[model samples]
Target: MDADLVECRACPRLVAWREKVAIEKRASFANDRYWGRPVPGFGPADASLLIVGLAPAAHGANRTGRMFTGDRSGDFLYAALHAVGLANQPTATRIDDGLELRGTRITSPVHCAPPANKPTTEERDNCRHWLDTELELLKPTLRSVIVLGGFGWQALLPVLAGAGWMIPRPRPKFGHGAHVRLTGTTTIDLYGCFHVSQQNTFTGRLTPLMLESVLASAGRTAGLLP
Candidate 1:
């Protein structure tokens, strides 16, 4: 079922651009076929922690079927996840690379690759249904959400509020290890960190160690590790 969604072509514009990029980079990902459509969420479905990224990169996850894979952003993210003991492997170069995630899952608010890495408000609204369904399926056992960047956090804030939980006073801001605890039957923790995109990493906005520390704290809060 999840596999089918990865091969989906529901968004025509996304499909065309994805194919165009794949063809342009033919030599690099020669044997690699573009997942090129809508990249589905990755990691354990029953995970206690959900890591929400902004969106797929043009040549990254948009080309590979897996989330946060085949891109520079993924390189930093996977390294951090592995350091925190959530991933069995530290490297994610392809879709079928046999990497495994433990007690964690990674997803994006927008499934399709957007032009210039920015999705319009309408596009994000259109994709919200998928995220809603995803949260519903995982809500039973979900314990925490780690939003990767301001955009990802913004997209999820309303969803949490709509679930009958009151948001914190002053609201939670997006920063490394910034967290909020919801007032509800099951308390869910929200943490924020800078996105692991090339711009951020290259500019030293988010260091590798900083990201690893955030994941380490999340694992502890969710009881996935000590």
Candidate 2:
């Protein structure tokens, strides 16, 4: 499934933008080879925790080919996950960086990198099937999800509902620390967290302690940790 997902060119705009960035190359990483394709989710298949992020950064994941890699957002996120014992390392510089997530899988609503870091509504809908399939595969062991930002929170609702998780009417609002439980053949809890974007972290809108609190709470809820 992952091999097939990386080859998708379902959204022309995203394809162009990602390829353009790959060709132009950020000055800092000018000499490095860019992955320039859809970034696939990373982690063990039996993970109990799922993290849904918005999308790959144009120069980050699009370049490194790993979700949140080589970006400030990933630095903040991995550090928090490490502090909570979910990740083995506090860095996700590249795909083979020896950083491993113990009981969590990280994915995004849209697999492709988008222009200006935002995907169009159509692009999101087109990419929904990937998340849907992922959730179906993860449903057995997945106990909790940490959705980063409102985009991921909104994108995941219908997918989870489609997977037979009973979503509440009107839906739960998105906010840091907001949580909702969906019960079905398998029960899963969803928790919202501010995205680890520079806009949030640099502005002090999402501090380390705040991220750790949410991750720790979710980890405990999922039984990843005592």
Candidate 3:
């Protein structure tokens, strides 16, 4: 999928709101042009473990054109991935920072930057097709997925369920190390740490150790590490 297409401003409401944010925050990101548009998936194209996040932060991935880059969330996420040996670096401050993934891929359910971090159901539904396509193109090798939150799990579950797999009842609720195995081949492990926003990290809601532990468990489950 082309990054530019994902960054599209087809939705009038989203376009207007994004433009406003760009105008208001012009000085901070003066050289940091807002992707002010949809963000595309990034990471190893042939990864086996897929990590799904909620959506792009207006000034974060939505601006940097890389999943989880340019934000506190990416900071925490990349640190964990690096700690687990799935990433080559410990920090991601820009889209072109040359960071690389070894065994994992990160993406969001909603490709576009939604206003206020909330995407309408219709918008989410529309984006699911892209998600489905991406999954299909990834092709038959994914062994596990790590969904970051309840909303992400909800968006992705139906697709997995439709593929002749059984999802757990009470739905395998989200929490650190929460996992569900489907069809004896693919496993969906959900780790529900608070999103690594400035609010959460600054408040100490999710510490580095906590996030690293989750990634460690995910690595073991996915057989990416011992």
Off by over 4 Å in 2: none
Q: Give the lDDT ranking, best first.
A: 2, 1, 3
> What is candidate 1's lDDT per residue for 121-199, written digit by digit as tens?
7777777777877887788778888999988888988777766568877877777779788767567888999999889
Candidate 1 residues lying further than 4 Å off, grouped into runs, are: 1-4, 7-12
Summed over model 2, clashes come to 0
Residue 81 displacement (Å), model 1: 0.8
The true-versus-predicted C-alpha distance at residue 152 of model 2, in Å, is 0.8
Write down the TM-score of every candidate: 0.92, 0.99, 0.88
**Tens-digit per-residue lDDT, 110-166, candidate 3:** 876678788888778777877787776554667667777767878888766665457
State the displacement of the C-alpha of residue 36, model 3, in Å, after optimal TM-score superposition.
2.3
Better of 1 and 3 by lDDT: 1
**Deviation from truth (RMSD, Å), model 2:** 0.6
